[model samples]
Target chain A: MIEVIRSGLFTTIQDLGRFGFRSTGVPVSGPMDQTSAAFANELLQNDPNDPLIEMAYVGATFLFNKSATIAFAGAICEVKLNNEIVRDRSVLKIEAGSVISFGAMKEGNFLYLAILGGFKTDKLLGSACYYEAVNGMARMSKGMRLSFQADHQQREINLNRKVIGLNRNNGIIEVEKGPEFHLLSEEDAQVLTQTQFTISPQSNRMGILLNELVEIESKEIISSPVQAGTVQLTKGGQLIVLMRDAQTVGGYPRVLQLTEKSINQLVQTRFNMDFRFELARESA
Target chain B: MDNPTVRKYGSKAILIEWEAVISPEINDQVVKTAQFLQENHSDGILEVVNSYHSLLCFLKEKADLASYIDICRCLTIPISELNRTRQIWQVPTCYDTSFGSDLVSISNAKQLSIEEIVKLHSTGIFRIYGMGFLPGFLYLGGLNKQIHMPRKQVVKQAVPKGSVAIGGEQTGIYPQSSPGGWNIIGRTPIDLFNAELERPTPFSVGDSIQFVPISIEEYAQIETAAKNGRYQLKSVHND
Candidate 1:
């Protein structure tokens, strides 16, 4: 078992996501950075869908009740075991009674910490992902205890893998035309590709707000199904990139949809960072 | 009408748009398409989400978009052959002053007596256009013109669950407590959404709902039964 000494900004237990429930209006809540989350599990040779702690901005401090093998990935953060700083993307061994803490977040918006056999949490709606108060606890609070599988205890395991040769974090985010893309004025459409927009501070799991205002000529469509990576042009001319936890239906005019790879990169985009959007298929 | 315009939404999904307008016929077509896809799902298909006039198909991997487009273009919806059976639910609502905090203000705006407003609302049978945004929050259509009112100028930070509200031409019940701009006129005792149940929502898209007015005492009794998981929501089959 692990006890939370001090919870960070927004820490929650997440898995691959809550699936097969969107039909009933449930938002799919998962790790903001999918590649990073998967990396942590891959190091331990565990199921990628196993539950792990997802932290926004920075991580938390925890007390390990038993010796466990763990891994950390995403966001160049300072993770320390006791007073000694540990490395990222490598299997870590923590002794019983050891206090593990993550210090200042250097870059990116999310981080994932995974145990060897995954956290033992209640499987609600076929997933261990924590959503709002309806299914389970929303976020980690101080004095929270998380149990893990005790049987799969490996003493000495060497992992020499690292997240190498991936440049998805920075660059132009690729997107495709949405259902209502044709409704935008020619000039407004051109501006979307020509101009750069800053990521607003008012971003959450639901969506990321862009600083620039878009000039859309079309009105709101009827409330329709919207998914993660959908780029919506609001009535106030603001552009919002819906995240994993976004509502299933919305009324805003969808102008573009970020590719799956772009969404993975989007979660790492920090606030006030300026980025441009490029068509996924330039010919199309 | 011509077949739906199928276009790739992203690398993992495709959008099939049947119409730009909202009507029962359009919604039925969308539902039919969703059902057809579900029955004939290819290995790469993940899930199909149905909305008012379009269906979003999420795929596991990249499939032959050209072949899928051909399938969509040649596909024909046999309206008569489709299963038209639908469930009509009589949802109980309490319009008492204690439950309906915005009743007086809505009454003043519409210039109708509170009892008259409730009567008109109860008599009208509402159609479910969509079931989304929030869990079990039904997007309903069909409201009495007399009771049609704009949403609250100031949105409520938290409206209680089962709050029956009206926002312009739309009237719906808040399945769970949530921030809303709609004007609450009544409250229901039944739980529109319960995670424990295999089927979380009692109502689905394309279903019809009728509000039945009950007194405060009856509301309490039904609320208790609902909490105990013994409330049998009054429903009937409609073809």
Candidate 2:
């Protein structure tokens, strides 16, 4: 068990997320930056799917009740264990009652902390992830006891493993045209595929309401079930790119949808960064 | 022979849509393409999601889309066979004044009595066009034009779970409480979503539904029974 001495901005518990019920309108609420989560798991050498603690913007200070091996990755979080500044994205073995603290990222929005054998929590839909705001603090809170495997003595975090390799690159995300792409005018379509758009201030885990270059209209498409990758054109013609926690159904015309991998990347993006769309055409 | 509209969806998906002013021909083509792709090309396809008039066939980025389109164009499922496989269903609702929050609003909007509104709604069998928006929020077609009503200008902050409602020419159930603009006319106690349960969704696409009106007292009885997990909805099928 780890004790939270301080709670930062917004942190929460997350795993890979609940799937298989998307057609039923349930959002796959998972970690915003899956790369971070996966990297933390790799550091601890835990099963890739094992549930971990997901922190956001700012992080927390934890006092380990017992000795354990843990690793950190994701955002550029400054970590300190027992008042000694520790390395980011590496595994460590700490003594019982040792304190671990982390600070806000200089450039990112989310982070991940992984432990060996994963965190223990009541299973919701076969996943240990807390969902739909995880009752809100974004993650763990002050004085909260986070249950995890502390029995393990030590583990190795490969210093060789690279973080922010291919996935975290910002500015351009790959997308496929949605079913109703033809509904947009030629200029709007051209602009949508070519012009660089900025992520609007009104963006979060739910979706990114982007500012597109040209004017467009939101005609009612055949009402259907939408998924997280859906990018909808609002009545005012701005684009709203659905994210991990987006609603399941929508009526607006979906102009384009990000690739599943891109959606994972978008979850970790720093706010207000200008991003452009890159058309990824699968060759015949 | 009907011309089917073939369009590319991203690099991974291709949508084959049939143009139809009326009838279920387009829907049939969509489902047929879905089945053919499912059975014949599962290796190349990642997922096949069906809409009202088109099927979204997801593919691997490296695969050949031109060949995939050609394959879909050549695929065929007999119209009668497709209809035979389609499932029609009935969903019951009681539009009592207490449960139906928008009963008065809808009644006034259409310049009719609550009794008339209920009669018009219950008189027609609705077609299940799709399932989305929220878990189990069914989008039903075939509404009686007499009770046609628009959605609320401002979405209610909290529409209760199981609110049977109407918007424009469509009627639906609010599977779970989320922000919605539909004019609710009744409430059902059955939960359409439960993260704790397996098989969370109650309905699927291509199903039909019917509305059965009940009184406030009867609504309470059924709602209580459903809450206690003892209620069972009755359904009739066509041969």
Candidate 3:
């Protein structure tokens, strides 16, 4: 068992996502950065889709009541285990009564913490992903005890595996033409590809709003299906990118669809960060 | 109807869309195609979401976009044979001022008495066009033109769950408390969505719904019964 000493910012247990419920309008609330989550799980020799703790902006301080093998990824932060500083992207054997605390984040906005054998949580709709609407538990708070598998044998693994290519600061997000991309005039489309847009402070898991607006006369489409990574051009010329917890359907004109890797990259970027959308090659 | 255009929504989903219009005919095609795809395309397809004029098919893995588009184009299920079973749910609604805060304002805007608005809303059998925005939020069509009102200029931050509202040519029940701009006219006592249940919602796309107005006293009684899992929503087969 692990007790939350300090729940910083927003923290929740998430897997790949909840599936088989989009028809009923349930959003697939998963990790904002899937690559980091998978990397943390991979380091701990757990399933890539195993439920792990996801922290946004800040991370939580955990007190382990039992011995466990764990790994951390994403967001360069000062993580201390029992007052000893530790590095991320490497497996750590945690002893009972060990207290792991996270300091101020140095870079990125999201982090992933994975334990061996995964966390033992109730699954709603075949997913351990925490969605408040479905599971009724919001973010983790102080004094909350999280249950996990206790008796898993620790296995010997490579400790110094170098993880690379996760740097998302390039500000180049690749996108494809959405179904309603044709609605944009040639000049508007050119402006969209050429200009830089900053992430708005009003962004959340549901959608990411941009500080810049395009002057395009956008009309509402007949309410149609939308998903994560869909870039909607609203009537007010606001470019909103739907995130993990976005609604299943929307009425805004979906002008661009972000690549899967771009969704992971965009979520790691902080607010006010400028990014440009690049149209991917049609053949690629 | 002409063949619906099938295209890649993104890398992982395929969108089959009809003509850009909202009509019963278009909705029927959307529902039928969704049903056909859900039944036949199970290898890589995860699920299919049906809307008023399109079907978004989510794939388990990123499949060949061209092949999936070809498969969608090859769908030729006859409309008559592809008719899936549908139900007509009689939803218990309370139009009392306490439950519907905007009832008086909507009555004034439509230039109809409260009783007339309730009668007009209850008399029509609405068709479930789609479910979106919120979980189990049934987007219903077929509202009477007499009570058709535009959405509120400013959206309410918290429209109570089960608040039945009208927005332009559509009416729907808020399955959960959410920010909305629709003009609320009534509230339903029974829950349209329960996450604990194996089947979250009983109603589905292509199903029909009829609002049955009840008194405040009956509303309280039904609310209690529903909370205790004793209340069963009255529904019948739609022939």
Candidate 4:
């Protein structure tokens, strides 16, 4: 068992996502940064889809009541285990009564923490991903005790294995022309590709809002299907990139769609950071 | 109806879009296409979400986009041959000012008496065009033109669950409390969705719904019965 000493800004347990329920208007709520969440699970030899703690902007302080193998990935932060500094992207063995605390995020906006054998959380609609409507809880609160499988076997530590660092890229987001992309005039399309847009503070798991607005004729489509990474143009010309927790259907015209990799990269970008959209070569 | 144009939505999903209009004819095609794809392509397809004029197919894993497009193009199910058994749900609603906070304002805006507004709302049988925005939130079409109103200029920070509201040509119930912009006129006591059940929502797309207005006292009774899992929603089969 692990006790949450102090719950951070926003934290939840997420797996790959909820599937087979989109027809019922269920959002595929999952990790904002899929690559990093999978990396944390991979380091601990757990299933890539195993449920892990996803922290945004800040992280929690956890007190382990039993021995466990764990890993931390995504975002650069000052993490300490029992007053000793620890590094991410590597497996760490925790003893009973060990306390791990995180502080002062240096880079990135999200983090993932994975434990061996995964956390024992109730799976709704065949997914362990936390969705407020389905699961009845949005985020972990202080003093919550999370159950996990106890590690009893003695394992050898591989000190010789080299850790591969995450590939951080420049703020260039790749996108494809959406179904309504043809509705944009040539000048509007040029502005979308040429201008640098900053991430707005109003952004959340539902969608990422941009600081800059483009000039485009606003028209409402018959409510149609939308998904994660779908860039919707509002009637007021605001661009909102639908994230994992966005609604399944929307009425706004879909202008562009971010690539899967680009979705993962964009979530890690902090608010106010400028990024330019580059149309994919194949799409162009 | 013409064939839907299949296009790539993202790396892992494909969009099959029909005519860019909202009508029963277009919605029927969208529903039929979604049903056909789910039944035939269960191996690679994860889920098929159908809206008014489109179907979004989520793939289990990335596959050849061209081939999937080909499969979608080959769907030749005739509308007549596809028989869909739909359910017509009778939702118990109360249009009192206590539950519907905007009832008086909507009555004043539409220049209709509160009784007239309730009468118009409950008389029409609405068709469920889509279910989205919130889980179990049914987007129903065929609202009475007399009571049709524009969405609120400023959205309410939080609209109560079971608030039956109208926006443009549509009317729907808020399955859960959420931020909304619709003009609230009534409230339902029955629970529309329960995640713990095998079937989350009682109704689906292509289903029909009709509001049965009840008194505020009946609303209290039904709400209690629903909370205790003693009330069964009244529904009928549309043959």
lDDT leader: 3
Worst 10 residues of 3 chain B by lDDT: B78-87
Alpha-carbon shift of residue B70 in model 3 (angstroms): 1.3
lDDT of 2 by residue, A1-284 (tens): 88889987766677787654555555667777777788788776788878888777788888998877777777776788888877533667778889999898755667788877788877665566654522222356688887886565455556444445335646878887776776777887777877767766577777877765356657776755466678888777678888767766577887787876787677667666767777676511
Between which residue pairs do clashes occur in model 4?
none
Candidate 3: tens digits of C-alpha lDDT, residues A171-206: 789999988988778898888898898888788888
| Candidate 1 per-residue lDDT over residues A191-222, each given as its tens digit | 88878888887888889899888766558799
DockQ, Cα level, model 4? 0.87
> Which residue segments of model 4 deviate by more than 4 Å?
A87-89, A153-164, B78-81
State each candidate's chain A TM-score. Answer: 0.94, 0.87, 0.94, 0.95
- lDDT tens readout by residue for model 2, B54-141: 5566676577888887877777665544654444554557777777988998777789999888888888877665565565667677
Best by DockQ: 4
- Per-residue lDDT tens digits for candidate 1, residues B1-239, read 54688877766677898778888888888888877776776565677778788888777656776677666667776656478688889999999989888899988998999999999999988888777788777888889888999988899999999999999988999988889999998999999988777778888778899999999999999999999988999988878
Q: Rank the candidates by lDDT, best first.
A: 3, 4, 1, 2
Categorize the docking of model 1. medium
